[model samples]
Target: MTDTALDMSVETGAASYGAASVKDYVALLKPRVMSLVVFSGLAGLIVAPGHLHPVLAAVAILCIAIGAGAAGAINMWYDRDIDAIMARTQKRPLPQGRMDPDEALAFGVFLSVASVVLMGLAVNWVAAALLGLANAFYVFVYTMWLKRRTPQNIVIGGAAGAFPPMIGWAAVTGDVSLASIILFALIFFWTPPHFWALAIFRKVDYSAAGVPMLPVVAGEAETKRQMLWYTLALFPIGVAPYFVGVGGPVYLAGSIILGGLFVLSAIRVLRSEDHKPAKQMFTYSILYLFLMFALLIGERLAA
Candidate 1:
């Protein structure tokens, strides 16, 4: 079916040729998150110590993007009720009634299956399995369960987002390696502090939705303390690639400096009574992850 037909079917519960607009279809893809997934997967592919056919690599990345989009769509569908009440997610298609929940669910399931199957057939089963696992974890484990039940939701759910690099590495080598796992661990450990910082400022939204985010349950002070602790732990883990031979001087230095800055930001958040420090830490966390990944790829290229 055409994109418009698919969207209309989901939106109006009718199979029609015309729909609201192409943007409606694009909205289902969660393009913002997809960009990060694609970039990280590409970095993983680039840094893998093996050759992948250019066309196959392109296809693998496409599958990863689609899988990520599918998971995001499912998340939006499942969280539509809570999302409708949250300022941050009020404009999402499902919560806004721009699309039907059943339609979103179907669309997500279709994309998830297609992406995994295509990845398996076109590349290898390892990548496909990882992609499938990520989708399942996001949809079932994160969106359906942890998101509503506990503040540590993002801590465990974050693993879904961290799998792209491992999937990309597996696409090239058809197996998991310590290097890929290290990359995964870096993101996994980094997610709590990254998201909890946002929660510190957005705790009101989460509280209204009845989501027990750490900041809401533990109080902002304790949440900030936990953020600091996670950052401290993440520092050595982030820099581990250097000692493991997967990274070089550039990555080692970058990880240390970036990790130190992250810890400092967390400390500032811990010390401040206002939201300014949390806001700064929240914004800088994105840059910290991106720079760390870039340094990894740059070191690989330099070597």
Candidate 2:
């Protein structure tokens, strides 16, 4: 669909929204995405070099999840137009006419402010600031600017998702350090290949939505090539925590195995003719990140 058509549909949809249930409001938060964000942030907190009161640690994590969810709500509101046209997003609250766009925006802004303020008060200002920055970047830089305009959207915007670990780390240490930055880089590098795998399989959805995802703009071959490059880079970055002394032997061994599987997944995507491998790669990418962070958390806690 064209931009004009999408806008028109969005306006029409916005005019007739029904009552939103608690479930719809929760859906607006993008819980699946929030889970991963919280998990990664928890890993960062666990692996960091200091101690936080259990209460403060929980508050920090809650803030991270809320900030991420706020960003997601804003993203959905802004992208409601294209979302209505896209198959994957068609059932979203806004596109489905289940919630008001203005309300969604307000809810997001409220949560954003609340999360940052709470984090600053309960945890540390550094983590709060990073949370605020991540939310702003996701909403303003990624959703509003880069997504429709550039194929590099995921590459640059991935930094927003990468912040949780850093935020968690900062929450414990009260500052950003090399270890936190390495955690940030791990997610930053892992994002493109992970997202591009989905894009490869959902090219038609992105194309119809007028989004310039890598596969939609550059074709599957180029997208797969880019995915391979990112995965190769990710391999070393994923295991770097070991050398940096953040992870132990178990983490080292597990990271190597996980990184190898991620590379192999990307290679399969590159060589496959059908969408199955890309879909599998997308699924595996989620597992790869989860396991990588799990190793970090588990190893640290055991120590």
Which pairs in model 2 have colliding backbones? none
Q: What is the overall TM-score of model 2 with all chains considered together?
A: 0.95
Candidate 1 error regions (>4 Å): 1-19
Clashes of each: 0, 0
lDDT of 2 at 198: 92
Q: Candidates' TM-scores?
A: 0.93, 0.95
lDDT tens per residue, model 1, 141-238: 99898988998999999999999989998999999999899889998999999999999999999999999999999999899989999999999999
Worst 10 residues of 2 by lDDT: 10-19
What is the C-alpha local distance difference test score of candidate 2? Answer: 0.94
* Model 1 steric clash pairs: none
Model 2: per-residue lDDT, tens digit, 265-293? Answer: 88988999999999999999999999999
Error in Å for residue 120 of model 2: 0.2
Q: Number of clashing pairs, model 1?
A: 0
